[model samples]
Target chain A: MLFGLLETGFVYFYWGNLLMILLGGGLIFLGIAKKMEPLLLIPIGFGIILVNLPLGGLMDYRYELTAQRSGVVQEIVIDETTRFAEGTAIVRTNAEILQSPVHGRLTSIEVQPGQNVGAGDVVAVIITTMQTDQSVIPTEPIGLLSRLFAYGIMWHILPPLIFLSLGALTNFAPMLANPRVMLLGAATQFGVYFAFFISLFFGFSFEEAASIGIIGGAEGPTTIFVTATLAPHIIGATAVACYSYMAMVPLILPPVINLLTTKKERQIYMKPKLRPVSKLEKILFPIVGAIIVILLVPSSAPLIGCFMVGNLFRECGVVDRLAETAQTSFVDILTIFITLTIGGTMAAENFITVSTLSILVIGVISFASAAAAGVLFAKFMNLFLKEKINPMIGAAGVSAVPMAARVVHVMGQKENKKNYLLMHAMGPNVAAAIGAAIAGGVFVGVLG
Target chain B: MSKEIATPMAGKVVSILVNEGDTIQEDDEILLLEAMKMETTVYATDGGKVKKINIKSGDRIEEDDIVMILE
Candidate 1:
């Protein structure tokens, strides 16, 4: 019997693996053909394909050692210098194992081939191997994607870097011009709590429920950050849901906005003029904003703090080189790694479950509820204010950035050609970024 | 008093939209400034005739640096 031939991955392949490969190709098609978030979708789609290939071992950790025998009383060799007594049990920490020499020096032998050791008992001791530089010299082969993910994401480094890049690219002029529009931003977070409760009703723990609720915020990095902390198992589904919804903002938000606001309200024209934000205000925004938000939600400091630092680099006008790197090169590189890891996390075994379907459905509901809440809140505010705010601008408060704001502008244009709502819509659009970050922080603070 | 049209941020002057001595209204774009891949139109704060153009296209201007003089 040729055992090696029978042990090939082809014998282990199943229908679910084929389905995941097709789904990955479909995402790639959507990214390339539909022009939807190509930067994220393409890498994630390819990662999905890479991880789903049976025997590819892209997601497996290669350094783990398993017992090869069920007996005792065999000779034990420990490197070139030492030999351990038979039946001597040995234990090593994960760090120690990873740092060991490439060939994995045997530390001891607890059982020999004929010693009749039971299952799950220690049979031998081998120190897992690594090179001094830690790049896994050719002797030991670690899964490439798994290594990147473990070091980059598991250590909690990538999400904040993404936020830093976002902050560098963002312009705060619109948000600063009309601070009150932030109320709409805050109001949009109603769906976060609403979805949290709904998720709880569906039998999710408090931590998982909080993570699911953050999908309504429509901010990808924030979603990843919260999930990575509270419910890491669901980060793949939640991040995909968040980014897909964000890309579909133009399609998803309009119907909800139209359903909630009448033509009269949508036609309410907002002046295009925005007060010029002062240099001092721009410089103070990140500093003061970080202090206030962090003081309120310390758990959010990592994401918010990095964001403010990047923004300060931009607005300070002294660090143009640093800001440029953060916005362009740094962001682009980190995005590729993060999206790839997010995709890799969705192995067929983990992704095709009923829980993923439930997450997808709940995510859409959360998004719709968020859009509705924003429009309804704007209408509520109009009753008190002498100057009526166009309710459509409220729909921009979901933190999809320019897309949500652009949708509002387009809807306003449909009602009145003379209406220019882009600038006014931007006020809430930028505020939603801050609002989503704060909501994520609140969830982590309460749940974590 | 001649009002100096100052740019609010440091950037390269991409284009001078108005010629020297061109009559301009308050908030009328005087020139386009490019920074961080974004184009910000520097607007005249006071309605006046352009008396002296202190900076031209392709000039690098600092915050509060005079790009044009309005009288």
Candidate 2:
């Protein structure tokens, strides 16, 4: 019993795990007590605590699992863990077949010889030391969560699926009522560019700056899509920052609106009843929007295409069943995994860097700048329009979805109790989300 | 002339602010609707007397559902 106790993970415990666990606890507190994005923060907080536990092995890469008694690292011929039959020779980068010391029956695999393999369904074992007489050494992947991350998130599958769910949930009626609010959404991208330059000034690589800057729009799936492609190493930081700040939009956006607009400007109101978008117009938007955006930025095809397809499912009116499922169960299930997997990436080793902290700072700056740009642009637009806009609604273009819209609505109500701005704000709310998606596509187009 | 006011979106009727036969002004709060976990105040579209109330507090409503008729 004493010997067995000694063999447990307690011996390897360190200060980092304790600190991260506390940090994770703080996130849980914010989600529950503060009611700040509980859906995302709760799972992510729990994931952090779970991943940081000693010897949990929840985040071990597949290559780290193989025990090498004696071997030299070799170049990777096939990075993917596709099917390999028993007794089939392993191919090297140089096209030289790996010679087995014995007739080894190596079947199940998800690996690269010398490099860390991402998520895979099979075990990747390369017979590194050919003549060492260590024949047929099999390996079991230790981390439970790591495999999920590698197979799901790392595969670039979940982000588009999430976008599909988002499209299904969206109501284009708001955006279509006022097509000009769409410009406010585009205006928010100024924050993306501003943050990119700031990150670059801080000595981050061009790609890293692009990925980090996307946090401004506070579109979680888009941030994940862009970061995963550009600066994958910083995904844990960017994702967490994106969500935490998104939850704080209600708090973050109000001050910025106050700074830029006068009391008279805040009290402005628009008509409650939109022009009432026809169902035919609703059904055509996804199709037309996809064509224009994808044509302009071909690299954004996956994100925008999936989003528009999902939107089509919602607006077509024929597939109510598919639309309902996509909106509810499909989206809820994906949110659990995507948020949890993101939290799983926040292990002490990956998250506690000085650079990660900087990403957090940059996130707030980008988000604020994005909201500011939207308000400023709306003010600029007022100069030419016969009818004035409530500049506060422009802040909804930060794309925190209904949260940003609600904040704008509430702020409007405070200024004038009779004002009904929610529907009007929704126009820019949805537009901001689209603008962020397009911004992500621009990055992927030029950089990816 | 009389007109019926329908909710433009789906939500739960949180509370009704007017009693039957009460006269109201345009943009007066008739009821509060909660949708997408946010509160939305449903305002009277035009000044009229509340002739019939079709929805009570905590009733789930759909788009274009007639909630009240005003004369």
Candidate 3:
């Protein structure tokens, strides 16, 4: 049988599937045993397990085919014997209009000459795109995950909704208090471009490189948004890397922060109470921020707009109910759907490849570099400031949110108990989320 | 004179460590608040006797919401 040809999933269960399952199990173990991002990891791991069970057809897909009108089979490929290329007239009824659905051998002609066919009949035996070989393409669409992914992910619905929930959960007061940290967040995007060029040097196409580079953002929804548009083949790998690495920010960030700073710098006390952001400022932030970003990168309107809207709900105070739902139950439901769907896409065929390995390696490089860049830039900014900001807070300038900020806060406490950087680190931590969305928009504008 | 202890941010009141009429000192743990999915201990800023509890366990409190009145 041809490789990738649909068959009993168990028959094709090879080392690839086993390996992916092990990786999924490892993710689940890390989430539970190590208490690392258990909220997202458990669902993702279970999804990987569900799809890799060799339970045939979990990821199958096909093109839709339907006859438009009822009529008699007037002729069959006029001058041909049995086969025709796509767009070639293969079925002709009275008025004559039917193109061959696929560019390969016809499995069979559904109708004979003078045979009556009904409108809305399943007369079109169209096969989906030739994934491996044209010979194995399915004649009809199959599987549930493919459709959900197509509409929810590729169609760009769920990513923005997920972003909205994230926005609702975000508290922009810290970022607005120390607006300068926005610079540190922007600096981290360097990691994206760094990995982009590195990916090209390693021979990935522009689209694929763009998708892979976004893993540096350490924001899973944004990575998914950009990847589904630019290069879908690598979404699975990039997403897995994005989330797995996000969970490991504690592991990856501390080392980079340590490598670049002196122990004295870590011990520097940062004020816990940030400048109180007024309600008006909080409300205006989402509006003005969304306008500026949408104007700059119109392509990213969906993500930025949704994010700002969610934040607006939170800041407005009038929509406490909406904000409440957006951050809580709404986010939980979306996480289940989005993460499980992501895991479903991580089929062994697509994931167990050289590209996945490259993405994982490049992801770490970009992640570490992003953290280093943040710390370094903060140190640079200190040269000009009267009251110096602790540089370790700069390491929180990734979109990992409370986790990244928490890591920085914990590290600060380790160095000096009096130092409370949670509220301060939050500035760059939240800014990094906006920074990533903005950078992702720019990339999508230029490359997508 | 009575001083009010407010939460630093919005979160669910995880547990109340001090009861009304209890004497507490500065920097004492007043209660636990869960925010951003992380639990943080809310501390007393000034030593005082708890006069009244304005919030109970499991109530969602916003930033600067008075959780307790310390006398």
Candidate 4:
């Protein structure tokens, strides 16, 4: 018995589990040492470690079982044999053979010898019995993280909250200063649809394709929100793909932007000053923007609504306290919980699959295509505009936020030292965020 | 009446674009405030000579707080 106990969890250890642990550790190292999305990656990495630990029971869940049937079997048949068969006589002989439908496993037989069992009686206690952990039987409760995860992510509360906090932190000046730049934002969404078609070609369902396509939006919250609602089974892989790609935007987008735009176009200087936005305009923007977007894509209302409301808190000039909370402490708390649960969801069984690999590849392609499309579209637009907007800013339209915009700024400076494109890039950068939200809403509305 | 230029929101004054006694035109930017990672330019409400300045670069101010007086 002691030997059996010693070998319990060890017998279940496999190469997959080891690899997952290493991947988790790698994420932790990346977060702490490399300082890549440390707020999210740290919790997520730790959660992954906790979940992958053998016999940790952090992921184990159990529930109560109630009896569904009361009467013992009156009929008996054994290989067409005409044995002593009818009434209580058969029941007496075959009572030991009875199986509880509620609990698939056999427990101590509830019915004692010559005892009558009634319906609704607790015939057998359904215990969580797993081969991985022979010691410490689980009680009748689901895992705490599992429950929080189900209620938080699966029920669709956390994503919008994250958006709300994001909105509180965002300043709409860039987008408002140059409204036409929104076209570049819309143009980048071509990556989403392009990847959608590609995923469909790979035999993914319309829902799955849509979920995968949103990765090109380059917004982690929107990607998670859409995937959790549509293709929930793949949330783990898709979210990782989204965030990993987002962090790699500086590396991924420049080549694509450079390849699409010539040195002349890259050197093109835009007027540095933006027309100052009025306080009234800033205050009205969130309210008006929300109404228009929600009306157009009701499915996107949750994320967009929260985002606009948070922006309202920032712009209204009356709710600085609320905006501060939303942007700082509240968001920090949500990020920890959300990332940890997201990481916990990626057990070896769920993450190490052909589908995960495919999603990762498609995610990168989606991001590349979005960046390329943005730059190409800008060049297309330059054909008509006299001012000749720099095409590099188009690459910022992929919603990787300031990172993509910064890449454009760096490229612009390299081409011409006098040129300052950070603010110019920001216009498309912020617009891309809205564009991605709209794309996500459309996908969910149509396919969800 | 001297026109008092006030900030529209709370933020750190990143720069004083104009100096006291400097001639300014209506809508000319007098100062820049950095808030929420975006810059807002505080413009002269009425074209006049700068009279008294209430805030300097790197000083924090609240909404409706007088930034400068123009005469």
Candidate 5:
């Protein structure tokens, strides 16, 4: 059991996360010192650093029945007759008891030589206690009630309290205005549902299905919140799967993209026509879209409401302060609580085991499938259109903001130098945001 | 192949730093432009001879619009 404590640390600790923290630190250096996407990368890197710190209990343990071993320093043997005798063994069989001392550093150095031992002046001491001391210790009847109350409060009461708070922080309203983008985003979400259904065949429950479904968004906070609400049981594994895959987006997305699309398709030319969006259209889009979505799926109202509210502020033209606050200060503050709540929810008993590994696999499939769906949909649309739309821009359907759009743009330019896909792709890019929210709403409405 | 830094933003080409066939190196300032109340410089992209000078001073340009081509 001495090395058990260290093994617990080693097993629970993620070396990949540790590496990510280092990678994040490097990104921060590149952003701040080298001026590469400073506005985004710095916070992201810091977020990576804070979230990756190992907490001993992220996943559950499967305890197996085994022969009880005596403490390393002390060995006790009993005959078969004495095995059932009263006071045969102070320690129960198969009970994990920490025989070693839990050391505490001594404070107040006043040890001259060896003065008479005082009541309170015991300097350094090793507190040796059994790990199952609570079961062994005899207490009053009230103590049982208190323990029961503590367990109830800690296990059941605290989680929902944290969940509701996180739910309050998320603003899903910005997804209202760009219906086209939202459609694409929602279209892309087929990957999540597809993965969800497939995982059920592999033996995940409905709640776990719901948890795995939201991994398509690649939004950590949203992923955590959905998993926490829908499947609090598997919150740990779900969250780990969510964050790990989200971080791996740059790595994962490119490979999936490369494998699916041919080089000729990647280089498709897109002539972007710059049509200045009217302020009236921008303002009206959110209000109309929100009403439609909220009316359709009330379960997603919280996320949709907040998202539209942000967009409303952005296009309202008069409230610069409100829009700035929503996008920056409000988002920033909420992000901290969201990340912590998400991270804290991953207690070991909730996470770990075979189910988590399956969820992670399902999440990857969902993301890849969403991307493939988006590209194929774009190609299908191109078949009917007179003015050719670059099929590569179809990839911007996933609501990853500038990253997805940039990928499309980069690929388009790779095909033809005359092609400028960024602005046109932004149309679908913004639309995908709405699409994702709608899909999220549908998921919640049907399954939540 | 030699490379030319085109107009990054909509601007008017204000002054020509090098004429046709003028030799320039990478990161060398080639010409200046006036746009959005700011003066911007077009840079030579490689260590090579300027093969062509397409625009002179006072020519209008847009974002990513080719200011010059080199070989």
Candidate 6:
């Protein structure tokens, strides 16, 4: 029986494939055991092994000998004419078309042979179905429900359940868009500057320091894009640090908030100003903000532009449809890709080091510092201001939007039942979004 | 119709501190509503004498139900 198997010529190649399998196994271990961004890294690591496996020419096109004539049958199976297994990642030799998940709307493509296309042009509108499944890379694309099976049972059920729970646990969205909440978020940003100096001690350049400092901001897209553009070499560590800290927000923020401000300060009663904002001011704010940001920091334009556009869409009375899309679907879709890419960039080799440990530490500290700075600034504002703004609401100045602000409101309401800080927090909350963007632009213009 | 202190959201009205025909100021707390784990005050948007209070402590209310009619 062994001799018969030896005659089939499978043993040598199978061993070779086994070694490749071992390589894949190593990647999985790195992603799973080491926790090096499992979502993207594990899939990519498995993909590497799966593509390399000599599965009797499954990945490629080939012909073989016929048993009747000499050996196995030789016929053209997969060829240039044959299309890719739908949804499988195939390198398009033709670089004319770009495939993008347009705001979660998946599109199908119809193509004829030998069509000329340019780089960065839309080839097809493929469905942007998110399947976090590693085992079924070669399988045809499935809808979200079916693909949920491709991933663990947890992946499908957890998201909606978690979102629902989160909606209930802490509805931070209102705070996210509010201005005072922004101040609180900004207060946490001193962490960025503090981290910047610390990274300098670790021998990072100014640009690298700025990239690392932003981890305190707890905004993933900003961190990833900044790191990718400024310090591509350290992108891996920076991203991992950013994400791990973001996940730890609940654990990280409270202790810092408590340590910075006393119970007496937290319990301070803030009389509601109840200032009703006119519709015209809301409309004018975004336009004026855009103009100011564009003039001051051209480099920051992209961040401010997208942000203001989203804000403008929300504020603009005429375009309810656009506003809804911007607030809900657009931001949500971008978030998935941004997180995946951020996770993907953190390779095991790049992430596991002393520098990464420092980045993570500093990142947490940066968030705390920003929160502190914001509260201090608010306290400072109280000295001269007649209204006697809540010092807690000042922390909302950071651009975490409604989350930081809502946290402030929650903390306030806990202290006194009548306090409603949500609306008051909105003023500084929106401002900080622009502030952070401008700061981002300044970093880019000076350093880039 | 007897004036009712209605619930804003579908939650227990844990406390109804006011009686019918009680003079209340605008922005004065009318009743205490517990919803989504937060105690919300149903304040009087307009100040008037509360007439014929229909809801007492622990009564439930729906959104936009007539809580009380000021006479």
TM-score (2 decimals) of chain A in model 1: 0.83
Q: DockQ for each of the predicted structures, in order? A: 0.05, 0.28, 0.15, 0.04, 0.06, 0.06
For model 1 chain A, the run of ten residues with the poorest summed lDDT: A93-102
Per-residue CA lDDT of candidate 6, range A1-448, in tens?
A: 9777544425323343455456557757866997644543465355435433322221221111111111211222223222232233312324321222111222233232344433333333332222222332223334322233223122222222222221222222334333444444445456677888988988878878998988766555566556645664465466656655544444554666677677877677655444345666666665676788789788776666666655565666687786666546654554454343333333232234567677767777776677678778777766786756677766666545445555666677676655666556655655555566566667778887
RMSD of each: 10.0, 9.0, 8.0, 10.4, 12.7, 14.1
Name the top DockQ candidate. 2
Candidate 6 chain B: 10-residue stretch with minimal lDDT: B1-10
Model 4 residue A259 lDDT score:
85
Interface RMSD of 4: 10.2
Q: Which stretches of candidate 5 lie over 4 Å from their true place?
A: A1-183, A347-350, B1-71
lDDT tens per residue, model 1, A64-154? 3334333443433233223222223343322122122222225345544344544345544443212112232222325676676667765
lDDT string, candidate 4, A1-448, tens digits: 8678644555445677688889889888988998877777888888877766645655544523333456553433221111111121112222343332221122233444445555555443332211111122223425656655667876789998999998998888878988989999999999999999999999898878998999999998899889877887688888888988887887898899878878898999876667788999999999999999999999999999999999999999888999999989999999988898888767676677788899999999999999999999999999999889999999999988877887787678678754567778888888888889999999989977
Q: Report lDDT per candidate.
A: 0.77, 0.79, 0.79, 0.77, 0.53, 0.53
Q: Find the 10 residues in a row with the least total lDDT in model 5 chain A.
A: A124-133
Writing each residue's lDDT as its tens digit, candidate 3 over A1-448 gives 6554443455446687798899789889988998888888887887777667654455555433346788887787644223234566767788558775544234345677888888866544533221221233233335566656767887789999999998999989888988998898888888888888999999999878888788888888999998888777678888889998999998999999999999998888765667878999999999999999899889889999999999999999999999999989999998888888888878676677777899999988888888888999999999999889999988888778778888887788678755667788888888988888887788788877
Q: What would the TM-scores of all predictions be?
A: 0.75, 0.81, 0.78, 0.75, 0.59, 0.56
TM-score, chain B, model 5, is: 0.80
- Flag the better candidate by DockQ, 4 or 5: 5
The regions of model 4 sitting more than 4 angstroms off are A1-9, A61-141, B1-71
Docking model 3 quality class: incorrect
Best by TM-score: 2
Give the lDDT ranking, best first: 3, 2, 4, 1, 5, 6
Tens digits of per-residue lDDT for model 1, B1-71 = 88887765567999999987789998677777765444556566677888989887898986678778888
Model 6 residue A119 CA deviation (Å) reads: 30
